[model samples]
Target: MKTIYLVLPCYNEELVIQDSAIKIEDFLRELVDKKIISAESRACFVNDGSNDSTWDLLEHLCETNAFLCAISLAGNRGHQNAMLAGMMMVKDRCDAVITLDADLQHDISVIPEFITQYKKGYEVVYGVRKSRKGEGAFKKVSGDAFYFLMNILGTKIIKNHADYRLMSSKAINALEKYGERNLFLRGIIPSMGFSYTTIEYDEKPRLAGESKYSLRKMIQLAATGITSFSVRPLHFIFFCGMFFFLISIVMLIYALVVFFHNGSIPGWTSTVAPIWLLGGIQLLALGVVGEYIGKIYMEAKHRPRYEIDKVIWK
Candidate 1:
């Protein structure tokens, strides 16, 4: 049998960590007992600098459970970086690692299927949600828009799939080569061009605590994902500039015609509308260009995404 280390990135999960850990530990043990997986399989909970007792609870759980390990970060490093830190810890040692949210929103039942696919020679097993049932209508609408936009923008990310997936040691090693400070795993994993498969499962609602995905974060993620993968956004600005230039030429011709016909200027509305419209478009173009420049600036610095403050295991 092969060993699978489940990597869970946690942040302020005090409300549900114990239950989530218990369920994960129990399921991992069942996999071991049924000879589906090796006894060395462990579930690692990464404490992403939670302000609550999340790390303390993990310490107690690690002390008592042989299958549980904990990684504590120096500060809150967001979900992707925390997950990356955990995968790096076990990539060289474990046969595979399954990363999921600590909130248990990812269905644990499909874990066996992930391992089965891994055994069948698939290097990557992606867990996709069949439907976002029971979710807020705005979340559903925005999520749909986000996925569609990402695909159109050249990032081949799986729809309805977050960071819940299985990666072989080989895949994980390839993943570590990505040294970008802004980590978008969904976009990067597909770019790996490895043999992979996806399993559809229903997403579960959070049983405890609130979600961390705010409107701002969602927009930021979408912008970052698009900017990280493609230069089309920069091209978009260029096209907008050309488009406005042509429009301005036509408008100038029309204004000259009116001026020669009546020896009078255009109406206030006509003059103000273009000023406001063109100004907005110019600012939008500048903002888009600035975002790309910012990404380049950050990448050139080669900063660490997350710092591991401690690693606890028994």
Candidate 2:
């Protein structure tokens, strides 16, 4: 049996952290009973400087559950870095590390599958969502558009896959060598060159707490992901410049045609300039729109929205 450490990153999850830890403890016991994971396997929760009682709850959980551990970051490092911190803490102690959120929106049932894939010599296993059936329409569209745009910008990412993934200790070691100041794991993990597979699960409703990732944060993450993985945005800007240059050349040709053929003609520039300008502007705008439409068309049939981050549990 393999020793697997599940690294759950938390921020302000004080309200439900205790209950969530209990749930993970139950799952850990099941794995231990089946002898699928070693008794040394643990659930490691990294507390990212929460102001509430999160760290205290985690401490109590560690005392009560043999397979539970906690790390308290000196300050909030947000979700990605907090996960990284947990992985770093547990890397030497375990054979594999599985990173997920504290709210348990990432279905725990598929965790056994993660261990199965790890046992098969796969270095990484991604937990992918089958659908976004219970989300709001705005979140659905925006999430769709974000990944669509990211792909268009040339970031190779598994659609509908969030941070929920398992990495072998060696893979985790390889991941730590990346030295970029602004790192996006979604972009970095694929480039790690690890053998990987995906297990699909129906994304569950958040068990507690409001989502920390707002719409603004979503855009920020998308931009970071794109910039980290690909320079297609620069390619896009260069193409736009070339497009304007072509329009300018066409206009200049029109001017030269009027000057050489009909020098005596009046109002040629005035007549053609507005028409060319408006037509060029409209075409450029439509071209930009079409690029996005092409992006959407590329992924419209693929994966569902990736994260919900919030759910008002009754």
Candidate 3:
């Protein structure tokens, strides 16, 4: 029998943790009863420095349930890092790991299909959402745009896939090789060469608690995804520079023609256009360079992505 570990990352999800825990426990029990996985299979929760009773609940769950294991981070390290921390902690103990959120937005029913895909030699199985049932139209549109932009930036991501996915031990082992401080799991996973497949399922409404991802976080995530995977952003600035330089040269020739033909004309428009255009171009170029430099600064710091404040296992 294969041992399957479910790694859930929680950040101030105290309201939904208990329900999430129960649902996952029930799912694992069903899998065991169906002989899909060994009874030794467990659900591991990584508490990402929740200020509430999330850690306490995880500790209690770990104590009461033999299949529960909890790792509490010292401070909030963002969702991707927390997931990475959980995977790193349990990659050695299970045949495969499925990382999911604590809100139960991702359907747990598709997990069996994920395992089936794994058995079929897929090292990675992504849980792709067939539909976003509860999200607003604005969110849906924004999400689609984000994916489109990511693709344009040369980051190949599985469409409609979140963190809810199954990864074989081999895949997890390969992932461990990536040690970048800006760990974007969704982006990074696809970059790791592996035979992978996807299972489509409808994303359900959260049973409890609001989504931890804010609009600002979504924008930040988009930026991280692009900056981490592609140099296209920097190249975009180069293209912009070339375009403006060409326009400036054309304008210069036009100005020279006007100067020779119609002598002594005060043309403020010509003077202001190049000044504003060049200034904007210079600032934009600097901004792009600064983005990469900022990332480098963070990497040079060599700080731990996440710190574990506590652990509970039984």
Candidate 4:
């Protein structure tokens, strides 16, 4: 039986942490009893510097339940970094690791299929949402747009997959070699070219507190995913520049014809329109380039992704 570790990244999830822990413990116990997973398996929660009683509660839970443990970050390092920290911490001890959200939005029942896929020699197993039927209009549209944009930019990501995935020790070790600070795991993992498979699961609603990922955070994540994986945006700017140059050449010819025929120059509207258009394009291109430069700046600092303030294993 393979030893599995459930790495759940938690922010301000005090409302649902206890309930999630109980459910996880029961599910894991069932798996252990069935000999599907080793008894040494554990459900590890990474507390992402939540400003609540989350850490204290986690300590209590770990003390009472052998299946539960937690790692407390010194500060909020965001979800991706917290998940990375948890996986890295437990990689050596577990045969495979499955990542889940503390909000319980991802279907935990599909976890057994993840293990079954892993047993079939797949190092990476992605849990993809079958549909976004239950999501709000804005969320559904944005999620679809994000995946579509990623595909158009050739980012090599699973269409409907998020962070819910199972990675073997081998896959996790390969992932550790990627030292990027601006991590978009959804894209990065697929680009690693591992033996992988996908399992479709029905997405569920949140069980407790509001989603920690607000509109701003979602936009930031989308931008990170796009910029980190593809330079196609920069290439797009280049093509736009070429197209505009050709248009300018044609306009110059038209102006010369008008000048020769009517003995007059173009109107202010024509001049101002081109000026504003080019200025906007220039600023946008600069912003995209600046994002890449900022990523490079952060990565060059070689700072730790997260600092462990406390660890509760027993």
Candidate order by TM-score, decreasing, is 1, 4, 3, 2
lDDT per residue (tens digit) for residues 1-314 in model 1: 89899999998999999999898889989999999999989999999899999999999889988899999999998888889999999887689999999988999999999999999999999999988777789988988888887777777988888889999999999988888898788899999998999999888989798987668877888788888898888788888889989998997899899999999865846677779888998898888889888988999998888888988976
Candidate 3, residue 110: CA error in Å?
1.0
The C-alpha stretches of model 1 lying farther than 4 A from their native spots are: none
Question: What lDDT score is found at residue 291 in candidate 1?
Answer: 89
Can you write out model 4's per-residue Cα lDDT over 1-314, one digit (the tens) per residue?
99999999999888999988988999999999999999999999999999998888898888988899999999999999999999999999999999999878899998999999999999999999999887789998888888889989988888878799999999999999999888889889999999999999998888888888889988989999999988999999999989999998998999899999989876846688779989999999999999989999999999988899999986
Clashes of each: 0, 0, 1, 0
The best candidate by lDDT is: 4
Q: How close is candidate 4 to the true structure, as a TM-score?
A: 0.96
List the global CA lDDT of all models.
Answer: 0.89, 0.80, 0.88, 0.92
Q: Can you tell me which runs of candidate 4 are displaced by over 4 Å?
A: none
Against the hidden true structure, what lDDT does model 4 obtain? 0.92
Please give the TM-score that candidate 2 achieves against the real structure: 0.80
TM-score: which is higher, 2 or 4? 4
Report residue 157 deviation for candidate 3 (angstroms): 0.9
What is candidate 1's TM-score against the reference?
A: 0.97
Clash total of candidate 2: 0
In candidate 3, what are the lDDT values of residues 1-314, reduced to their tens digit?
88999999998898989888988888899899999999989999998888999988888777877778999888889889999999989999999999988888888888888998899999999999888877889989998998999888878899888899999999999998887998778899998979999999888888877888998988788778878999988888888879878987997788788889988456765687768877987987897788789899999999888888788876
Top of the candidates by TM-score: 1
Instruction: Judging by lDDT, tell me the better candidate of 1 and 3.
Output: 1
Please rank every candidate by lDDT, starting with the best.
Answer: 4, 1, 3, 2
